[model samples]
Target: MINNHMLKRKLDWDYRQRCIYMTTVTVEKRRPLLGQLTGGLGNPTVELSDVGIMVAQCWQEIPTHVPGVSLLEWQVMPDHFHGIIFVQAPQEKPLGAIVGAFKAHSTSLYRAGARQEAHLWSPGYQDTILLHRGQLANMRAYIQDNPRRLAVKRAHPELFRIIRNISACGHIFAAIGNHFLLDAPVKRQVQISRSVPPDALAAAEADLLAAALHGAVLVSPCISPGEKQIARAALQAALPLIVILENGFPPLYKPPKSYFDACAAGRLLMLAPWPHHTDRRSLTREQCLALNRFATQIAQEDHTP
Candidate 1:
């Protein structure tokens, strides 16, 4: 039986709709047969191995085999691949079918060339549906810059790394995104979203301040103008905050001036699930919603007794 912790993709969701899709597939056992990551901190590059070159060629040919699918940005890493695919029209096959076909073809070619019969790909993959154009741009930049981030992580694993299942204040949170660590236990955390109205923003800000007065951590993505105001207020008041970001944290990342003191006080945590992009300036609607969902999840998990 599949562990309940593993979430199956929505089987009933329609994939024929015209939209942008992102998917990631890793090699079996995460072997670094695809490429070698090299270069310095800000200018990392990927040197494709023999297998990596084949993977790239196969990825480029995905659009040719898959009807109604157009390839966007993609990257072949040391042991994984990240690609953006756009479904331009309705099709008989869904996104999963296209991915499966690509995987099968790639695996066959790889095994035949390498003279190995072992499985080439791990089971299942990670995917996301882009809701708007902003997200597409963000994802494109992210895919293009994976090697640079990987290089930095490899060079400085102690400074920039993914820490899994961190427990704070009786709550378990994973640092999969760009985040800074705070060692405080969370108390009275509240969810703040971009959709809150102006009047509601004031009330929410007041409530957040009151909660802070009573020692509560403010959790939010702070993407909207209104939500940002609350975050600014929380920073000024020296209240603990858990800010969810849309992009990955850069190497030796530090909080902004507004939140510097709070971070220094060990009352701030920033979380993201994306790799650091060198030129990301905006967040897409889909990214905002996802971060808000994460914020809500964090709030729900902060159930301190």
Candidate 2:
């Protein structure tokens, strides 16, 4: 199951509304009792253990037990389960209650069969409530590829690891992705102001992309719209990049799919000097300026003699 380092729910969101949610329920202590990934990276498949199969069966019965819950897609991973479900409007229970019932029922079944663990799942689940149809489609693709992705990570552990206490640009950070990106001799900071016009922003991005193509590591705080657009473009072009963040990495931290793939390819380095936080954060003006300054420092420190 995904870690609940992120909040259980959106801070002020109404859980009663009709929403599409992707939830992750992890096994207690992350035991691989559910299943194993087979067929290798070439043709990955989840070979469900007996318990895994039973748990999956229980997942299928959630709708029958909980009204206003529709199961869209689900994958029972070796250590945790990922499910995409739609909670309809005018519901009898919120998303948490529905998930709680499923967990309770599954544990009962597991215990009835004389399982060792008192509980099958961890205390709570992590949820991602999709905002739009585009996000929903991307989540579907993510769930479908979960097995293959896990297989690939198993094949290459070093690239996907979270390494703490990394020293770079006279600062310490908890970092994920290729730490080696910091060593590039031609690192250039991309500092675009929010006030830049569309045309100038386009030009600035093009210049950065050209430099990236010529073996320069592009660094950015990625706070401003222009910077964000350029950063996205840089990743799309598969160039090396270093991103500065205000928040640090949490335990069992994994980057999103785009960043994950970039990390696997050793083309990205994300650095955060501050400690990790679970609460949703809004960037203060002071923090934004400080992070932008950090990008400049990171780039300057990497310049070769």
Q: For all candidates, what are the clash counts?
A: 3, 1
TM-score of 1: 0.61
Clashes of 1: 3
lDDT of each: 0.70, 0.86
Please give the distance, in angstroms, between residue 220's alpha carbon in candidate 1 and its true position after superposition. 7.0
Q: How well does candidate 1 score on lDDT at residue 164?
A: 49
| lDDT per residue as tens, model 2, 187-215 | 88999988999999999999999999999
TM-scores of the candidates are 0.61, 0.93
- Candidate 1: where is the Cα deviation over 4 Å? 1-7, 159-305
Shift in Å, residue 87, candidate 1: 1.7
lDDT of 2 at 202: 90
